[model samples]
Target: MTGPVRHLHLTELRARVLSEDPAALEAWEALTNHLANVKRAREKGPRGFEKYYEACRQGLHRLSLLAGIKGISLYTSRHQFAADSKRAGHSHPQTAAEMGHASDRTAVTHYGRRVQGRPGTPLPLPSPEEVKTVRKKLGPSNGPHREQK
Candidate 1:
């Protein structure tokens, strides 16, 4: 784990940087070190990370345009992480904890729905007899409004 990092709203948020290549971690360390030592590059306002956040947003926007990928943003990573976690068989609570949510409801309601192909048993389809029975009980439909005999 690395040192404490600040979020956009100047709140403390713990984040784990995962990378397959050692060079990526090395670069991240170097960037953090550089930022720590240097004077504020932008205006006096905004926490250091916030300034960088804007820069990243602009840079990513330009890069996405060039690559012809629409709607790419920083939050995309978060969504992807949630989806990946779910597909990897993580429980809702586990994913919620990792994502810094207070309860599993947020993770299950929002993040959990992001998994493209959800795991677990498929819902059982009603048999033809059951379908007929239900249809008979409901009677014939007259659009949205039911007719009174």
Candidate 2:
């Protein structure tokens, strides 16, 4: 939760969150709090809290990186992006996430494989019996059907 920037073991984490950048600081605060809670709750052994906590940590890291790169926190940058997108003609979009300029379409895809051991069911390899029909369809190389030969 505490990054290389230092200033950990704060006298009060919640208070620090209030004074810091909301989006970036809040994310790290959430991650730190979730970790603390999970550590204490683990006596029951991985009751699905780990995944949610991990998501929080990932979100925090993402927001922090974006904030550092853009010299703006996620909260402000998102607002600015939205305002710009709306002015550029995406005014009535339902979610703020949907507000993007025409040329600024962003696509996110989770390209996971669908193999047997994979997340989705995988297709089986063709058996010898399956390919026997392929040869029949084309016929023999020197057969009557092979007119060019």
Candidate topping lDDT:
1
Cα-based TM-score, every candidate: 0.48, 0.21
Instruction: Give RMSD to native, each candidate.
Output: 17.0, 23.1
Which model scores highest in TM-score?
1
TM-score (C-alpha, index-matched) for candidate 1: 0.48
State the lDDT of candidate 1 residue by residue for 66-148, as single tens digits.
99999999777666666655565554444445555544455445652433533431112223332232212223332121112
Candidate 2 structure quality by residue, lDDT tens digits, 1-149: 22121112333334545768575476666768866876666654666566655665667668878777544333443454334333333212111123221111220111111121122111122223322322122222221111112
CA lDDT, candidate 1, residue 16: 22
**Superposed model 2: Cα runs more than 4 Å off:** 1-19, 46-149
Which residue pairs of candidate 1 clash?
A: none
**Candidate 1 wrongly placed segments (more than 4 Å):** 1-46, 112-114, 117-149
